[model samples]
Target: MNPLGPGDPLRLGPYRLVAVLGDGGMGRVYLGRDGTGRAAAVKVLRRELAYDQNMAQRFVREAQVAQAVTSMGVARVLGAWYEGSWPWMATEFLAGPTLDQHIEEYGPFDDLGVRELGAALARALQDIHAAGLVHRDLKPSNIVMTSSGPRIIDFGIARPEHGLTLTLTGQIPVTPGYGAPEQVLGHRVGPPADVFSLGAVLVYAASGERAYDGGHVATVQYEVVHGEPNLSEVPEPIRVLVAPCLAKDPAHRPIPAQIAAACATSSGTKPSAKKIWQLGELAADIKQREAAAKQLISVPDVRTPSAPSRRRLITALAAGGGTVLAAGGGGLAWWLLSKDGGQGEARKPSEEESTAPPKPWDAKRLTASQYEDGTTPPSLWGPQEGPSPVVVQPLPVRDLVLVHDGGSTTLGAYNVIDGKRKWGTDVGSYARYVAPSDELVVTVGPVTVGRTGRLLALDSATGEKKWTAPADAVHVIAADAESVYFTARRDWRQSDVSLLGAFDMASRTTRWTVPMPVECTLVTPPEAATDSGRLVLCGQNGKVVALDTHTGKQVWTLPRQAVAILPIAPAVSKGIVYLGGKSLTARKLQSGEEIWSLPAKSEFKKTYGGWGAPVLDGDALYALDGEEISRRDRRDGKADWTRSLGDVLQQLDPPVVQGKTVWANVHSLDSGGIAVLHKDTGKPAWTYARDGSGGWGMAASGNRVFLVHGGKLTAMPVF
Candidate 1:
């Protein structure tokens, strides 16, 4: 039975409980107030849990650590004591929803929002790390979006540097999905692990998708250790940031300072001292709205006509008074003259002042052709133009590209550079996946439940479908300039039979189909083309088999822990294939020999897959994590420079990179307006409101930004 109810009070030391806020796995959180009615959140441990000596000691230690930390982003512990059979701790009551609740209610946050959250949390972590503490449970549920800023809660799972283990038998200290690989394996974890968990939390907050997902706990754990994170919906610019945080090895993960700096650089927005003030104002506004709603409901209506009886009496009195007034006018005039000696003088207006005309609420509209033509001469590759499409809205600037999940059966494409209609073609029953190549577009469609697949090759410049094939029997893993390679499953009924195959693009012929072990799932296809004459396959059980692309012959097989195989296209400049899953491993295409394995930082806990497939621009490999995007040395994965984009924002679209400018579109929770940011340095370039219609999606190309609201589309110039 619950002991607390609305308006019920229970005294505990210096505070009196007003009501129960919530109950979690560990204890009950209460809304409490002191004698003077100052409110606080009181956490009371469960009787069974409190009875354990080790757990009780840990609880006290957490309280002490929390009290010692002075960061406003962390909840400050105010009091602690044991009452009756329960141990309790008190902290200042924060009036806001949990990060999880906020995301669920409002969807994912935008780029600006993500940046704000990332920076604030980074600062919070800095304090924690400085104090030699690791907040192992740094999930969204433990973070409160308080009026002042994000306040991290739940120190119960926090681990200090010196005193780490504080657990009872049969009590597993774990936060599934958010836990790092080390934590899942029951290995001793440190601050780096917390950073990894933080990345996972940010990914969830930003994309509303779990980085590692499976039907069961064991499967999820397996995927966390070996599978690539499903980041299909995550924005591209931010995707790079989330990658390193999900690195399997903790040592390779980035520190808090690096994370903070990276985020600042990514969003070009730095955390300011006024964040707390803004947070407070936000909280106040929420409270005000709630109060107004209550007041409106409680007010009574008063609308009734007055009685007619008084009307007749007043009319007769008025008739008699009129005659009297005519006679008494001379007397009344003398009385008025006595009452007032003179009238007041009026003031003159200033010379410069004049009545101004009201401003007109006019909006500019650009047609598809006008938008496209605007990008023609000077900006050759700008977005496309057409009757504004109902799908993903295109942005100004040629580099911005749109990858859309077409309705029902078709996958659509619009060039962001000039708002030009690139292509809209039907692939299958449902086009679930779409990926871009320099010269080709790869689209995957699920035709049926467990028995269908279709892979369509489309001309990049035009919307013409180059070829369509039955992909259900074969996994169309990846493609390149030369050919497409796929892994085929034979007796899927046995759960283990599969084969690997390759198709020559020019000849339009199947080159080879090599048999493989049973129950094998194809990782990402090899990055190199079939013309490179090599194929790589990683099985569900962790066997990596290399094959000759032209002939069905095995080249070599390497054993690894069953993990997701992230296929990298053979580097065009460097000629190395980068495969990353639980760990980042670079292998030679011809020899299949190991090149190098850079250990992930110890703090990273979850894998949202490779952030951006080891983007190789030159000698540098660009990577993304929860906190920031980093450029690392391609040869040894050495850090060069890092930039941070704050926490994940709700309703955020993936970022698009143009020449030197990276653009991200974000929508606010309070007002559904669109905010565009320069991706390189997370700075706001422009913010436009859509009033009540609400923005659905946006894309950039050339000079125009195409916005979609319901069925209506509007185009705005990038400059």
Candidate 2:
């Protein structure tokens, strides 16, 4: 809590404000007391926004919603004045830390404690649902632990059951990793959505980690909508009780009633919240908070000179939970403030104006069936023939899979759903040169007899040219958010000299162009990958160079670490790049510092087989060496497990990890198709065998694996 500042109102209606609990963009929360000596957490609209009709109405709605819910698991509303020049609302002051704070201060709860917490939260949801409301945001930060039990707070985004989830232009509706799938998808939410949130909350309470987490917000939200809930750290008994509540489909989830019943004790009695809160370290913490609250409120007023500065005293008390009284109330009504300070309309994902392409097809989640052991999973779309074998995996962008048309020098976009051609344009290159940048596909046009090739950006959906760059490009190496890196001729006059160049996507101009090594030429364009701020270029003869993406300056280089006649794949993650060829190596992205290296093994002692590009998923790095596929730790080059194919494959293709299955292209004299291996054990699960094959080019997206072999293209479910 902080001392009252200039222009701070000492009182609101009957309550006299003492100290500030917290303040944010929307409003300020103050500790107040009434004539009867009753304490209340008073929330006032910011003076700058108080005059706005929408902001003022939100305060009224919050008060009404708070008062409508009749439950011991929430703070009771005291009084509200929305029509006044300064709108404010008061609620019963709550002491103790929030659920997230407690979880951080003390460890996760025991099994019994988790059950009691779940039961109380379930009942709270029951009350909130009965009032025809859905608590759109129910993360740990919105839950406060009082002496009585856990109390849900911050109803800022709460709306009627029919309400569509939406937020301001720059804000997300709910917290990442905790929001239910429907909420994350911007769908209309109901009581079952709250049940799903409860399941996630219980997971965190039991395991001390989020049920769904990722490096980015979009990634976490994607996991909630499509990925499975992570329950590996959760105890078995609790897992059985909570798993049903996290079902992706709202209809499949257990309701609050069912959750409450399942969490009951063996005696057929519901877990007691009071008993749970009155014991252990939690009880001690709560008692200390209550004592501090009593002592702070006992102070006569902020003007009492005899007392230490109320601001300093309350700020000190804050750490002990004394000033935690409705601290969440300050930023509670965030959605009320729009860019223009008017009521914002509901914005659904499908309705929003965005340039990002639609996510690729996810057939497995739609079908909801796991393939039986030893049985090949069915294809989601096709084995439709006509596309030539690809050097790179087919790119799934928007609704189409971009590939090189069969034996033609044109880029073809095929429908991801049914493997039908959508559009084809003469890109004058193979599939290896096409790169996706949101809705735009970047590629190089065919360089005619006397004219130089041009860089083009076509709409992923319509294949219409959107932007272009004048460069004598031979190959479209790769693209990141900022720029596209490619190998191009110096100019029409110096057409014989090959140069490495970057084209800024935003500015639509040449960023920087630098001469490539004498070994790198136009005929054999290097295989390049860009990420973070570095561009990794690997030559066909195994020369590797790293250049700063911002400026075309070379950062580091590796001198023929690989002895492959083919392009060695360089995969980047975090700050390290994993390369495969003569040896599987992990090196620092900025400098050529070696992190770890593993020698490739072969049946013949005199020969060293090349390793495929390393594929990274979580902590595991997977690559194929000769006939053996190995899964090793990404941090160190130590192998976790390995599986060998009796017959060698056509090429050293990296294994693709999707869901729980690792899909690898297998081609031998006797069998040729896709090989499915268990991600954890590296044991063969099933194989889809195809007769007469030139090996398969594979890519996994939206829970489906896309394979391009010979003139055939197919999409299979991940199982």
Candidate 3:
């Protein structure tokens, strides 16, 4: 379980939630206390599920069965609140390691251990079946090992075997690799299905991985229905007992009672419950962590006589009333002041900020190599493997082109002039966004499952570790010489609110955190709109706001628009912020007034890479619409020259404009290359052809163009 983050609820229903136990797509599990001082685990369902009538009904019915089970091997459900706006259930809290975590950490169980575990599970399932319900979703994670024995939990998909099914064929929810063929085929499931699941579970306990490949759902279903089960590593006696339980036909599978008897008969002396702790230290670690986190939180005294009044206060607090439970007291305690309280009137955008000198396009200058054909600077690195390749737009600092290799999990500085790696550091073993500045290189990777990602800073020249701090969940929106900006949520697609913050490296804290007025639930962080040292934030449904980075204050904001404005990075040049989204927009940096805006000419492909940010050059603003790049007068948005690369370069990097020449990187493998266009006419001045191996986005300094293609960094001269 992760420590409770800011804004996580402290109380729900009649229970005072103390610590987060786990979180899943369905909801959150929190350790809590009831009004009687009894401890329990409370599960709060996702709000979106409230709108699904069918799902809500199933949830309530399942909760009843969960609370009704009397088996010692099952965690008892205590209470549930289904009719309220937030649906939650309280169950007897179990402190132990999940079977999944245990097996993952300690490897597979021995043959004797497997038989013992199988016997315990068989008896548990038999009891559940006697209750007339089928635990349709039984996986390793659902089984908790206590000092006494294995206990089943999470009856989310459980239902009476004879009851009319709420889910239809192919729609029934079951964890793949554990579900029976009948469940996968969406046929009516019964106790025999549990037997099949048990067989699969035992197979996993004896061997580390699952019986059927779980890479693809459809493939897994097909295999579960027809393919032979994988038991190559299973030892003899337990293997003999498991083979018959996984029979293709449910009727052929042994009953739980018979299976248990057979396993026990052949099994040696049963292992003691005290030895269960030997599964690994995972459970112990969780308890230790939970104890530490609880030290900072004020848990509500649910057993107090005034509990009803306190709960009402908490309900009100959720609506912004600001009540807080006092530590060590059973009575109502502190009231947190509202953020709006005492804050003076909101600041208005001033004309000075709007009329400030339009900033020039600020980017690294790459000296295009003049070395002819031999100048295809040698690649600093070689090929690596992984489905996710680096999103190349080489960041050049001095003579080094900073690049990341996701396949190799390395971040390095390559000499732009020599193409030799100067220095490299292991960033991590996952996809990360690398942002470069004059002094530091910052990289943010995906959230580490239960924990947030770290913002790692490396010295620009040495590639040596500078500092490490917590970062927004996935990606960096923008980075400057002082701080890194990012969106807070782990997955943009799963969040309603994204926290936008600036982390100050020196202070090791957030300079400021403001909730973006948009829903950007994509995997990566939404790009920030910036110009002239000010940040113009884009939100879905037409919300755009500008902030002054120096004082961490809002400058101006725009009203809602008809379209979502979750932009790529907004470009600022000549005092105007050019925003990209479903449409292109130009707004005054100071006053948040729209200079001009245009809807996309056509839909772009669904890929994560370059945002369609407008490119600013001299008096013109260049923006992408479909496959075309159009230029307009920056002053009045008057039309200028427009060009199309036919059907090529759909994933475009922002074009770099210098004097009368323009350079843009093309993303392609077979035909991808650089195209140079005349600034005056929307026609190509010349083109540099590559075997589609050149990276997207070329860095220009003086007359040199630096590009990273196919994991190699190179520099070439702009003729």
Candidate 4:
């Protein structure tokens, strides 16, 4: 929870506002209390949004829709006042994590647990439908797993069964992947649409994967409208019950009553709601949040009979890690805010802040056409003499960009704000092989006659040695918060197979070591990626292997996953690893199960060329295929838009994403420049044309793109 800032109202009707539970584009949710000390989650329309007729209507409609439904399976609305200075609505505060959070933190539920969850949600839908309303959005995030059971929340889009789908201009009618086929097409929807969402939710609960997914929003929506649901990982018993709810035709889908009956426990009876939520890791987490919420609201009686001071409230919030028990109906802001807030310090706002939203910054001063027409925006700072012409990718660490020219054994740091040199170090190591670990930079020192390769670290700011480990590392792969992963060889010249190992950052020791899979022969140095406790080794021989980072146990392996000649750089995110080759594919990081794959060859037999490594930003995957730079859906690898670059060298280098531009290096016979495309529409934004190119690289940080070409480094503005 955040402390109230300047211009924030102290009270709303009879409820005295305390800390801010959450805030979003539309409004803010606050923790409030009445004279009797009854806690509530009060939602108020944003001042700017209140002035918007459409937004104001939507806010009032949410209150009306949420209030119409009365059931034990839904959060209860306490009161609402739309015609007032600050339009607000209050609902009973819930103290448990949403179903989405539970599934993410604790893993997918067991079969029985999924059954209970589905049954409860189905019954909730029955009540909502009975009230002649349809819960348009019923994804996992909207359902709170309270101690009692799963309670449906969020009615911001709920409407009468007869109402047509309507949203703000440019807004998708429903969630991309979870919405039913009818909803995805913007067709009229009814209770069956909610059932389809329930089925999607159950699929997520039963298996930690989405029912329909893609790299981009359009791809997911396309799948929802035209493709089959992915229920391959779901257990047979659960699949049978949930499949009917996801029928493409609404009339063919099961009703809420039927779904509840089919999803009941094996004993042919409804499971105990309380018992389900009071067991396992999920229960423990929910209990902690509930306890924290109670402590946050526990105010003492004083002689002055006044509300608690801001300092005292902040103290209480700090002790509870700022966990807010918010009304599920209006808690989207809280959910987004608390996403990363659980692990570290709570964010305390300043005593005053402007009520207006932050202003958007310009992406770039010059457009792609403008640059081609001989116009240039002054460089943020650079064209400074760099350390070397043959440089690897520049690593940005805090206020500096670290450069390691492959030709030199020295590493150089330049201030990002200005192109001034900060420091330089000579560490008897291959300058190109380096990875950043917080304040220290990890690198591989050259092997000596008496010893194998050694791991070394240097202070990023001062160029001072921090620590060294005789771990026999040959190349740095990647680094996470805890450890730095690398490939090593006992005898660098003798071994064709590299050993994978990790260096513990905190203890400054080698954590574990294991041989690379025999099939993964490193003809060339391999590329690696790490995420979700798995380190993926992508070899040049088309063999990919995932190993448990902690134990070095092989989790899964894929043979001939990509072409053998070029090293494949795997991109990992959200527990999925993406590989680009004959077919750009997404697979579960831990299990190596394919989520979606897009073939390189089109139906017309036209070759788009094999995709280069892909760079993912939010929902889009950008990669160069032959002469064309395409933005494809990460979920399904379907190209949303593509721009053809007449003739360019197709290196393994993935596109770089900064601000609103997708930057790609196009090395043509003449003087190739970086192609700047609008991230969303793939429109040509601008080109950073250069005069000459032997080899060049680009890295972006702090709204600036660092370019290295012609033996000089320059910083360019970005959208």
Model 1 ranges with Cα > 4 A deviation: 1-9, 164-172, 266-719
> Candidate 2: worst 10 consecutive residues by lDDT?
346-355
**Every model's TM-score:** 0.39, 0.51, 0.41, 0.57
- Report the lDDT of model 1 for residue 144: 69
Q: What are the lDDT scores of the predictions, listed in order?
A: 0.52, 0.72, 0.60, 0.72
Pairs with steric clashes in candidate 2: 386-711
Please list the residue runs of candidate 2 whose C-alpha ends up more than 4 Å from where it truly belongs after superposition: 1-360, 365-370, 389-392, 491-497, 518-524, 603-608, 669-671
Model 4 agreement with the true structure over 367-442: per-residue lDDT tens digits: 5544542344568877878657765678877677887642457778888777888887764444344554547788
Model 4 regions lying over 4 Å from their true place: 1-14, 17-378, 428-437, 492-497, 518-524, 602-609, 669-671, 691-693
Q: Output candidate 3 Cα RMSD.
A: 22.7
The predicted structure with the larger lDDT, 1 or 3, is: 3
* Alpha carbon deviation, residue 439, candidate 4 (Å): 2.2
| Predicted candidate 3 versus true structure: per-residue lDDT over 1-719, tens digit per residue | 23355656677777777655555556667667766766667777666775776777676667777565778877776777674566777776654456775564344565556777888888988888888888776678778766567777766556888654544345547777788898877688889988998898988887766788857887887888999888876757667888888888999999999988986784443333333333223334334323322322334433345443433433322222122212110111122222232133212111112212323322233235422332333322232221125554566676666666445466666665556668866654443444545677777643445566667777887877787787544556676544567666534345443667777655777777776645564343455644344666655444566775544567676554324333455676434677665566776565556668776665544442223666765446766655666777765666677788655554434676654456665544467766667666776756655566535545665345665556555555443
Q: Model 2 residue 66 lDDT?
A: 55
